[model samples]
Target: MAGPRHVRPGPMVEAWLIEAMERYNEESLERREAYAAQVHLPGAVLQDLVWWALQALPDEILVGLDVDGSQAHQPDVEAAFAGEAHRDGLFAGQGFVISEAAVVNRGDSYSVHHLPEDWTDDLFRSDRGNRGGRFTHWLHTHPNAPAVPSGADADAAQETLGVDMILGLRFSPEGPLPWFDDVDGTRRTLAAPEQPRRFGRRGPPVLGVAPSGHRIHEIQLIAFHRTGLGVNVVLVDDEGWPYGWSQD
Candidate 1:
């Protein structure tokens, strides 16, 4: 892929992605929850840092998208993987597609989350799937929250090389926490509902109903460089076609 384009996830990967977001809410907000919703992707390594995302039982799952051209884009730009070229010669330049990923990090909500020095020293060592646990860019989920970056999320981005992404999943049966929409920024959703909406916003949000019986109200995905410049993320199929690429 050479020209600017979209990131497409293969069918297998898409099957569980939205569900992964839903799984975030399934965690009990009352305590630290460790649900085994893991994603494992096989990739390469760097001089000391590992590029692969691994499985960990952390409070938050830091999903490192196996971004293309991550190295070149590192000090500044991401590197293009050899087989990532698109059929039409158009490539996903601005952001990443969730074709494959790995998991990282976990902790209680009480204290601040940080990549501990021992974390990098021990986990980053040469291993089977990953070497050092370093990544160019990172993404995480916000259960029952909007996709907008929180103050903590922005603080985490400062440690990243390329960009940081947030996958926000909103659902019903909200429990003690209520849905908050007052915070403002550009919002991107999967598909607007077909029903006529009475909302003040431009469109009603796309509602993905997962088999888990959760009423998924909205799925938000966004990326931004550490500098705070917003990055565009295009959900695409394995064939490099935009997901739901049609006007219905």
Candidate 2:
């Protein structure tokens, strides 16, 4: 692989993705459920997925490869993320970045594949053939839920050659969904989650407001191989390098 150019998003790309993410995220909140979409910043020879991962925050997002599972679309964070392969800290060994997201129309889902009505038949069977052959990776969102996989989600991973990712968002006006903190497993978050205050063992929760005006609680992103191993994710720059590469 060639060395990274270490490019960052230009002004136009920055403004566009930020505005788009805000609109899309707010639209999802208006319906009070899950939303799916992709983000990409065009580099000279490739499309960068980190811009998508960063912009779609306080909401669930999955960053994986393009439809063909192409390496050209991967993010440059791994090298910068791992400390030149010496110490990766908590985030290490991540498999892929997104090629681009597959966005559908505005919608809601308790889990993403309880997907929306707009995710109609054409998503599966294209005019040419099954669209499944075009993708090697997959990702989905878990609104008001943890990034952990459900039994159904595990079954869905059987087809992936790269890895599967889950993006979970927890925010307020929670409606009926309760924050599930009882589960045991490793989790990676974009922002450190604020713990709910308890008056006693069963106290009602107190939440905080996010920049988006939602009472945000947590943002989680996790990736796993089809065989059931964790993959670390690091948000990076356009050239497939982490943002901090030059700081050191």
Candidate 3:
């Protein structure tokens, strides 16, 4: 008898596979968060980062940033305020700035592959050192996808003690907008998580009418600690003015 023929997955099977993968990724995220560390980022930095990520839309890209902050059992309002007052308190407890971003060349269709080990080393060596804030975060874009961690993402994140962030981008005829989220490597809990309006879901049903008018493009942002703690993300303009929340 001939061997069984190879068959492609049908739509239903494909959907099931996608759902299964999503569930697996979510569970993996939960496991990683259980031991993740906490991080705080400025709204302005986030805004700029997302905008940059969106520019790479239809293709994924990698970004690196220097993080400045000290560990704290709880968020220190004074430290945060002091940092803001001096513009140098980012090294203070629970206060951070995601600064000095550099876009990594990942070639075309980069999403299908991981960063080369040599490239990762080079990025860190060139972008971080004793001269400035340490390379503390790895951010990437997920065009037209939810701001959720993937299995591959989880695996790569294991290589760092720093935070891993994902910027989700979905474009409308209006323009390119993106959402951001983080995956913790230390598994520590965060004190606050930003909440923002979501777009991208289908419009509400109406009798004899299409819901095109109700359709809205959305951008979502979130952050999580290794211990499954959600971190708040504040989106701001270049000058630090509030733009929106990252969670709900």
Candidate 4:
């Protein structure tokens, strides 16, 4: 009988994953829910990268990359973080990474600042020439908010065919109750309600509350396309094990 294979991620990647998972495991339910709302990807590797970036940086960050597999691509989709700027920002500006080592010029806010037409053209050309893959996805962080798309996010998605991801992270000392088996003996945790409890045009808040005296933090990840497609991101460790939350 053959033994299970062990795949090793890079040193930096492994370090980041470990730190991110440590923080995630210690976070409160509100934080986990925030993470659940926005982060999704096709594989554990990508998810780990997203988680690491979200936890390590204090402000917003961005990662751009190309996909290396098909839906037929199977259980594994290789996210080739091949460009130099596989990670960028905690910066004041926004723009795609076009070269192996492109650095976004400094701007002044969480939102991506506008770039000159000529500068953008040059970067686009560089990306096309040096980076062998198309810029297929962009992941960013939201310091202390829900993972839901903002008006600006929506508008930006319209300009590209790629998916946009947001990771919402806010930390607090309070925590939620630990998961326990259901009384029904189903061995499952509680399920979310299927229908609204009250009658109103807008749906009730999907967010959950912590028990009295318990503190909370917020972490969420969500992805959307301009065409209205939503992607679910699952966080995992370097070895592809699920973390913090369950896929089910």
Across residues 113-168, which tens digit of lDDT does each residue of candidate 2 receive? 33333333554644322124334455666666777887767775665555677766
Question: Against the unseen true structure, what C-alpha lDDT does each candidate score?
Answer: 0.42, 0.42, 0.40, 0.36
| Residue-level lDDT tens digits of model 4 in 79-196 | 3211222222211111222111111212222344223232344436543422222345555555444566666666656544456666554433212323221222101011123465
Please give, for residues 1-248, the per-residue lDDT of candidate 1 as tens digits.
01111233322333334333223222211111121111112111110011111111123345555555441122111222111221221222233333334455444322323554433665354441221336555666655566788777776676665566776556555554456677777665543335766668543444544544455566666666666755544333333333333325
Would you list the rank order by lDDT, best first?
2, 1, 3, 4
For each of the candidates, the C-alpha root-mean-square deviation to the true structure, in angstroms, is 13.6, 11.9, 15.9, 15.2
What TM-score, computed on C-alpha atoms, does each candidate reach? 0.54, 0.52, 0.47, 0.42
Model 2 residue 41 lDDT score: 22
State how far residue 102 of model 1 sits from its true place (Å).
1.9
Report the lDDT of model 3 for residue 108: 39
In candidate 3, position 213 carries an lDDT of 27
lDDT at 158, model 1: 64
Top candidate, metric lDDT: 2
Weakest ten-residue segment in model 4 by summed lDDT: 183-192
TM-score of decoy 1: 0.54
Model 3 off-target regions past 4 Å? 1-38, 69-95, 107-113, 116-134, 173-216, 226-229, 235-248
